[model samples]
Target: MAQIQASIEIDAPIDKVWSIVSDLDSEPKFWKGTKEVRNISKEGNTITREVTIAFKDSKCMQTVTLYPKEKIQIQFTKGVIEGTKALTLAQTGSKTRLDVIWDMKLTGMMGMFTGMIKKHIQSGSEQALESIKQEAQR
Candidate 1:
């Protein structure tokens, strides 16, 4: 398993950050790599989403586990993708510290070509964090 982790401090309450991060439908806006997300199914803490990433050649199906105001974890349920996870909204002092961890395994050629793309995605994640911070602080 490979993990790409990024963290940033937001000058807002945990609840504030949770509102934006928990809404999976609007993820594409702040998350640079996410081009679009459609909610396929939802029940309790589980939601199935179809997402098209910026560099990805095709859409991917993701099964996301939500923990209300605490965290949200997403993993690929189908398609060429292997694995992915995002941990959101960790509290630190009066502000909120959000951390996202992604673990992925590509098949065939995509696996070999993942290095540069992985770095780009990680950089985008970091930028997304800063965007969230600015929004929350406003």
Candidate 2:
């Protein structure tokens, strides 16, 4: 298993940040690499989403759960990389600190490219945070 992480401080209150993050339909506006997000199904608190990445040739199916203002967890149910990811939020004074962690497992020969995958995830996380911050601050 490989893990990648990134953190950013958003110039917004935790409530505003949580509101933006919890809105599933607004995901693509702030999520990096995601070109489109389609809600496949929803059952209570769990939702299945189909996500298409901008440069990727294929899409991924993920199960997502929102824990209000605390965290958002995602598990890759079907995709090239299989694993779980999370976004955690903490409020400090007037700012909200957002942390993103990606825990992924590669298959076959892809396991040899762990370093590249980690870099990719870290970069994506940073981009996603910046986008989210902008949206939340607005």
Candidate 3:
């Protein structure tokens, strides 16, 4: 069990950020790794999705449960990385703060490279937050 926590300040009001963040299907608009997101089903505030992330020779399937703009919990039901990720947002002053907490374990042979996995994920997460900030500010 490894954990990575990070946050970024977006230059936008909370509502403006929420509007973009709450629309789960818009991830490809800001995230490069994400190729597409399709909502499989929704019940009330929770949504289940089939997420596709582009990689060499593969298309990863991530089953995710999203709680609107408050949080998103993900499990990679089909991929080399299998674990959980929770992303949340909060308001700070007049800006929006996005925070990410990732708890993950690598699948199969990849499990042997725990340190590398965390570092890689942390780096990717930081980049993703930066992209989110840019998209929200636009």
Candidate 4:
């Protein structure tokens, strides 16, 4: 198993940051690699959503369970990352810090390039957090 964690400080109140980060469906727009997100169903904080991820000549499907305003965790119940968890919006000195914890088991060719893959994904996460900050602050 491999793990990658990334964090960013957003210049905004926690609540405001939470409002944007908690919205699971809007993640694709902010996270470039995400192609689509469709809520399959929802029961309170647990929501099952189908996520499409863009890649070279292919796409991957991932089922994500979200704890809005707090966390968004994903796993390939059926692609790349066996599991992924993103913890959002921790308040600190008037700013919101967003953190992501990704745990995965890479297979085939993907396994050989774990370091590069992790960096790319972490960068995307950082970009997403930046987008959230801009949206919330505006």
* Model 1, position 128: C-alpha lDDT score: 87
Residue 100 C-alpha lDDT in model 2:
87
Q: Write the per-residue lDDT of candidate 2 for residues 1-138, one digit (tens) a residue.
A: 888888999999999999888887887777666778899899888899998865444588899998889999999888666788899999999999999888887555667876776777678778888888888888
Best prediction by TM-score: 1
TM-score of each: 0.92, 0.87, 0.80, 0.81
lDDT string for model 4 (2-22, tens) is: 687878888888778877777
Candidate 3 lands at a TM-score of: 0.80
Candidate 1 weakest lDDT stretch, 10 residues:
105-114
Global CA lDDT computed for model 4: 0.71
TM-score, ranked from best to worst: 1, 2, 4, 3
Please give the clash total of every predicted structure, in order.
0, 0, 0, 0
lDDT of 1 by residue, 34-122 (tens): 88888989999999988887765568899999998788889898766679778777778898989998898765667876776678878
- Pull out the clashing pairs in model 3: none
Model 2, C-alpha of 127: deviation from truth (Å): 1.4
> What are the runs in model 2 whose C-alpha is more than 4 Å off?
none
Candidate 1: pairs in clash: none
What's the lDDT for all of these models? 0.83, 0.84, 0.75, 0.71
Give residue 84's lDDT in candidate 2 (0 to 100).
89
Q: Please state the error at residue 69 of candidate 4 in Å.
A: 3.4
TM-score winner between 1 and 2, please give it.
1
